[model samples]
Target chain A: MILYLMCFALFLVGVYGLLTKRDLIKLILSIAVMGYAVNLFLILFAYKKDAGIPILLEGVVQGSMVDPLPQALVLTSIVIELGTTALLVALAIRLVQKYKTFDITKIRRLFG
Target chain B: MPVETWLYFTLGFMILGSIIALEIKDILSSIVAIGVVGLGVSVAFLFLQAPDLAIVQFLFEIFAMIILVRAFVKKDYHAETPARVNGFLVAISMLVIIAIFVSSISVFKLLPPFGQPLFETAQHYVDHGVRETGAVNLVTAIILDYRAYDTLGEVTVLFTAILGTITILRIRNGKNAGRKGA
Candidate 1:
């Protein structure tokens, strides 16, 4: 219960950073933080007390094991996050080249 | 110590690292701080009995750190002015966030209690996963066999992201191309 709240708090911190930060790099960092929170949440859900990893071993009884579903989901999500982060970094690099600044506030020509 | 204690500690470190990452004045230091947080999450994954996730997370964190450091090196700006955030807006947003978090706690109560997951199809996966997929590791079985479509979608997403990155970065700016070597 408390753990879940803590995860949510971490997520809110990311959201706060996303809302308040002006730097493009910081924005990307916040997105990464949010992704971490979500991945942690799913892993927490799959956990079981005293359970072994989700693998079937020979000569060992299948007594108890953590859920494999969420683990699979998180696996896919982690790779997807990697791809997005690369894409975002590429975009940020282009932005820096064009504007000569990492600060988002200075790149307001689109608002005009 | 119980696993919960270790989990609490890891989560605390992650939260603290996240705060430091966001509040740090130096962008490079902030990137390092975020990397620590990512590693902490990977540790938490190991503690939760998900070695597969822990391994993937470890690799992902390394690659992510490399990319972030490269971005920092390529950055044009040397002077980082402290973020000038509006105090009033921060306060309002904090209050709203607190309210939403409190409300969500009630929703979380509907979820299964810690360490006691309510399994439906997951039970079937555990019982028949090895026989159906011939994979000893149920997670691998799920990813590569039962839920193969998800893997396909993930691969497609990676392809698209790579394509987009290549396309965005390959553009030769007419004016800046002469000044800056791209």
Candidate 2:
């Protein structure tokens, strides 16, 4: 489907940035982008046509709900992404402090 | 507009924002652009019938933006790293990899087409999850009850990350702290 391919494109965009970008902050953002793409893909998988949210409510048919398992898994993943972003940012700050530059290429200690 | 239309719009917005974020020279602009992508994803979550995820995503976007902004404040605003590898070569290689990936996936037909989910396990949860777990929201039930151990592990990972961040920031540089006679 178009959605799946678009999601894959989003993921590839992240990969391209990760591979090509040199700034530490850009690398962090690329990682976050990849996380978003993956989370969206999982949510897309859980969707059902015309299904309500997966909360049991009065007068609402239980069967007419989207899958909840992936939602729960994605919740965990989102939190994990947050923690990862925080840690990466913290590491970036320390690297900046030690090396005096955001460019990874400039951070090398032993120059030929 | 229909929900699908709006969803597509948001997805396109996210893709555009990500591209802008990466291509822009200004670090602050890049951060704000990625924030837009995150907010658009939160909106997509709502359209996809996941309010809980929407809320979490909204909160996450706010927090992530705050952290990134705080970290970047008063720091170098513009950084342009010249490409060490040829841009054209990277592009061609990526295209080849993507083509291979797409062809393999299409030949295999790995995923069920968009709307049709394989819900064999989910059916049991939807039927008896509320009665068994006493949680109206099946997602909450699964997270808090059925997968409590997993939740515990998630919390532990978060805690460790925060603790590491604090430890990394708190320690003084070895050079700054004069060493005692060895």
Candidate number achieving the greatest DockQ relative to the actual structure: 1
Judged by lDDT against the true structure, how good is candidate 2? 0.86
What's the lDDT of the predicted structure labeled candidate 1? 0.89
Pairs of colliding residues, candidate 2: none
Which tens-of-lDDT digit does each residue in A1-112 have in candidate 2? 6777777778878988888788899999999999999999899877888889999788865558899999999999999899989999999988887787888878888431
lDDT of 1 by residue, B1-182 (tens): 88999999999999999999998888788888999999999999999999999999999999999998876754453535666767988898889888999999998888888998776579889989888889999999999999999999999999999899888888878765666443
What TM-score would chain B receive for each of the candidates shown? 0.92, 0.85
Which segments of model 2 are wrong by more than 4 Å?
Answer: A59-63, A110-112, B81-85, B100-110, B178-182
Q: Each candidate: RMSD to true structure?
A: 1.8, 3.5
Worst 10 residues of 1 chain B by lDDT: B73-82
Runs with alpha carbons beyond 4 Å of true place in candidate 1: B74-79, B178-182
Deviation (Å) of A82 in candidate 2: 0.5
Candidate 2 lDDT score at position B102: 79
